[model samples]
Target: MLVRINPASCPSDGHLAALTGERAFCSEFKYRRGMEIFGEGEDAEYVYQITSGAVRTCKMLPDGRRHINSFHLPGDMFGFENGATHRFNAEAIIETTVRITRRRNVLDAMTSREKGAMNLIGFVTQNLQHAENRMLLLGRKTSLEKVAAFLLEMDQRQDHPDMMILPMNRRDIGDYLGLTLETVSRALSILRDQNLLRLGGATQRRVELLDRDELARLDA
Candidate 1:
């Protein structure tokens, strides 16, 4: 249920247009790293799809700790809400571009041609499923297990060849994985030392999973 909302008529755009029967219904916007896309408690008037880079959706707890609900990478959608207002804040993790359309327009368009509403259903289902899985993973997993699971999740989502490029940094990964930044780094270093994976690139974001089965065993 990903939406690649490029302004040009790419294959993703064509697929969406076929579903909604409306061509060129969305507009694109760009945000710099750390820029706020939308804030918590704001009106949920639109739906957004990332064109490039990444965005983090999060909320602050009473203790001032931020818990990240999810990350939206290129070709993924966000900004859907159950109520009139947004429950969490959304910010660009890097220089990112996103296409957006009015929620009402989406509903009206679905009412017409895409009676299946499979896109919306699938999107919502995945969101719920991810949340449920994270609740368990965060509650009981050790630092090594959490980081290993994180790598596996990113590998599945990004579909890169042998190497996985991470867009977010250590602090962002810590926030999402419920660990301290040092703990995240230490876990990755341990995995690299064990030859379960190798971290490369100038920023060390390029990750090659050497033994996915071992990572899976730890995750299990």
Candidate 2:
């Protein structure tokens, strides 16, 4: 579940290495399924990269209801913010490994290198685009459309074209799509009834899309 690394994967050319020293590359950790990586309002000490598995960033309402914002899979970076504390909590949806770099070290690297600043800007910009898309999904899309969009997005992340493995559950899906769990379940059932998808098991990890065209149309 939890792992620590003294030296981590870095750019081979030693460019980033020269800027951040070997010590900066330390502190990689692995989290168990449903493990909390960081808590809301916790000090923003480091930024993380998903080395394996998946993570979900979410927030809780005053009444203790959770709303999942997004899911991050391998190669995705998260927990990077220009603030003293994290705005949301990050938890592993499944077993996950993440590489971390101290916030101060990252800032120092950016300060010394224009390219570093640019790269950080680009990362933030991409995240902003994703957030904007989610906002649109939440504000305008119907329940069916939202589920369709979620499926398509998950499909893109999958390795096999014919199958997709969802890491999170229906409740998490509902929260992310701005629907209730019953609504999410109903939409998925409709998709199945229409022969658009075949669910593999109760976990809903394996799904085969039988009608991508129809699914795409639902999003329109």
Best by lDDT: 1
How good is model 1 by TM-score?
A: 0.89
- Each candidate's TM vs. the true structure? 0.89, 0.86
Model 2 bad stretches (over 4 Å)? 5-24, 111-114
Candidate 2 overall Cα lDDT vs. reference? 0.80
- Local accuracy of candidate 1 as per-residue lDDT tens digits, 95-136: 898878777866787776645388657667777899888998
**Which ranges of candidate 1 are over 4 A from the true structure?**
1-24
- lDDT tens digits, residues 36-149, model 2? 999999999887777778999999989878888889988676787778899999999999887777777767866777577666667677778988888888999999999999
lDDT, model 1, position 163? 88
Best by TM-score: 1
What residue pairs clash in candidate 1, if any at all? none
lDDT of 1: 0.83
How many residue pairs clash (N, CA or C atoms closer than 3 angstroms) in each of the candidate models, in the order given? 0, 0
